[model samples]
Target: MILYIEQEILLDTQCQDLYLCNNGLNNEYLLISSSNQCSCKKVQAIFCKYDHDSCKNRCLLEEHLLIKRKKQTNSILINDSPANVVLLNKNELEKNSEIVFICHENNLPSPILEHLKNLINDRSNATPNPSLHQTLIGNFLLKHSVLAQSAYGMYLKLQQTRDNKFQLRRHANIGYLLANILLGFLCSFILYRNFDLYQLISNEILIQTENLTTSIKSIIEWLMHAPAGLKLNQPLVDFLARFYFYHIYLWSGYLEVLVVTVVPYFYKILFILCLLGISLAIGAICDFIRLLTIHLYCFYIYAARLFNWQIRLLIILFRLFCGKKQNPLRNNRLDSHLCDIDQLFIVTLSFTIFLFLLPSIFMYYAVFTSIWTITILTVKLIQSMNQFLLQIPIYEFYLWSTGSGIIRGTPRLSINYADSTEDTVCYNFNFDPVSFITLYRVCNIRLSLFSLSFSKLFLGILKGKSIV
Candidate 1:
């Protein structure tokens, strides 16, 4: 059978008697051609001519051809004859165009076509199944590997479609900011009106301050004795104890004055902070804690400076003993030098004195260093928590959870083979909910700031720099 589909209608070259029949009900035109008797009685060959002009109406023609072909196919099947089904593009039929055969149905009962279709179907529907080993190792790598996270992040970024407009995000941010401001004002108003609540807070601060002062005094006295059952030079220990105790007394006197003066106005300061924002108020509280522990910080600095100075002198004396001197003109590089017997004696004596004094200096440095570190970490932890609260996208998460369409993600396409037959396939499109990982990355939190490097901390302390 030979078929020519055109804009108006077309006639077969062999059988010019073919007629064009238009169905009045559906307003569709069908070309009805008479079958020609051929030499191959069992085999039927069909030829089709498609034009560029009719390409726009390909869907309609395709449907009509399928219906007509089905009817002829049923008859051929009844007769147990061989047949072939082919679809060609208009470009392929033109001069210098390539000839392509879409499908060839033979009566030899070949399973190649069925096998190929099954393979394609299975591939399309395949889901990943990781082995137990792979699952465990992959999870570990993902958590600990920076490269893995970066690669996954890049893959997600590529999957996401670019959308420059951020009206929804902007609106959400504005709403959150307004809500925060309103809540801050309400809190400030409540605190300002409630006198007893602020008075209690003030009393609590004074009590904590007094307790801190008493604790410091007791710790100093304990150290003056053999702390941790270690023997120490009594005269040096007593001198250091008296030094710390004097500072503690001074700090206590200062706190006593502050309790009568500045501490009474603590609530007023809190009210002012609350008016700014809850996050600001939290930050202010952290700052207040640091301020209260300023004496500890000062003690740490003094101990670190004294220890570093002693260390520097001992290093110089050791170099003198090694017959080497630091060349100040050459960036403090070591240079060989011959020292006299007198110089050697003086270097050895100084080195011994400094080394013996190191135990007392180290003891004070360690104690104050620990106290300062604890105070700093507590303040930093509070600040980090405040920052996390401020940066978290709670509103966005709520919108996504509610399916409000405010948060959009990439749409995934799925093929629905249930509605599909041998001739046509159906496609379904849907969108998956945005992942929490994506939301977290969007926030860009600086978690690395909290990461500690012990080497860097030790170097900084040796260099007489502030650790905090």
Candidate 2:
């Protein structure tokens, strides 16, 4: 268990030994050599006081020298040829001096010892430690055994921590998906049962088909006047008019569906909306995970492309004559033109008021049609709270979705609108998350074909305005 080392080995004087000094004083041992520092220095001069024990004394001296020599052989000089540090075995250490230099190296606590035991035999209950020596075979086995034990304990603790975090993340994703599915089913059921609810409420004043057609015509007329209206300094009117007409047209179609269809037909529409909402919710979750999985992917694709908090804000301000750039340069005119296009989109989307302006109508439709959207949207927003004990206000979550200045994209995922520099402001609202998301992004490709055709028709008008 211990190693001995010596400074040097050399014969000295003042060594005294005696043997058969039987009866009448046979012989006397005498000490020789050395000055006052006799205790510190090696002694010399052995006396063969007795003949019988003379050989024994010589043997003892030789054995002592042999052990010391072994230690000296193992001792390495710092600047020696090999220059590598070598560990000493029992023989090498025993040859060293009685005083040995001890350095203790420590290991971290872990659970890997349990892993090792399980690997060897499934039925074995013994947990091994990293510091524990499984194959004890030498004089230093006791020391190594303790080290192995400590290592195994450390491994177990680390494994448990990793497992817990993974479980928590999985549960959160599952909760999100479950809520969406329930909402989708509920919405479809409601729509299937109450087809004529909207018609009954509006007292036929808003005949679904006729009203929707009239709204679309009015919106097209308003769109024709948008650019000129922007130039005439009637930009706000131009914006609101276009916004209102478009949303009314869209929602009116939902209302019209009830009178024109049977239970199955209305159910089909509800089913579609529910499906779209669920898809949006799923995409939102996927986007969140992808955002965390890769750093650059989060910034470029999700944050910049989908959310677009900065781009949308700049466009809004430029349309309102309050853009960031002062004294716009001729060279940067293209940038200003792009802002104008964004402003138009913003105006058109705001018309529905993100389902807020038409909440009564939407809720009636949902109550009568797909009631699941409200439930899904509501629960999802509530679940986004950072802490379970302190739930964030549901109204606050709603404001984040339907409120102006809240940029829309996917459900339960909205960001406060920011200027071109991405500076946060509390003034006017900019985008509607629900309408843009459920209407544009989540809908099928066929739905988009209709929208693109509508956009092209509007674009043709804009081109005509430019020529004039």
* lDDT for each residue of candidate 2 in 131-181, tens digit (9 for 90 to 100): 333455522432322222222222332333233222222232233333444
In Å, residue 219's CA in model 2 sits off its true spot by 7.2
Candidate 2, residue 410: lDDT: 24
The alpha-carbon RMSD values of the candidates against the true structure, listed in the order shown, are 17.5, 29.4
* lDDT of prediction 1: 0.52
CA deviation > 4 Å runs, candidate 1: 1-165, 168-172, 175-179, 404-431, 443-455, 458-464
Clashes of each: 0, 39
TM-score of 1: 0.59
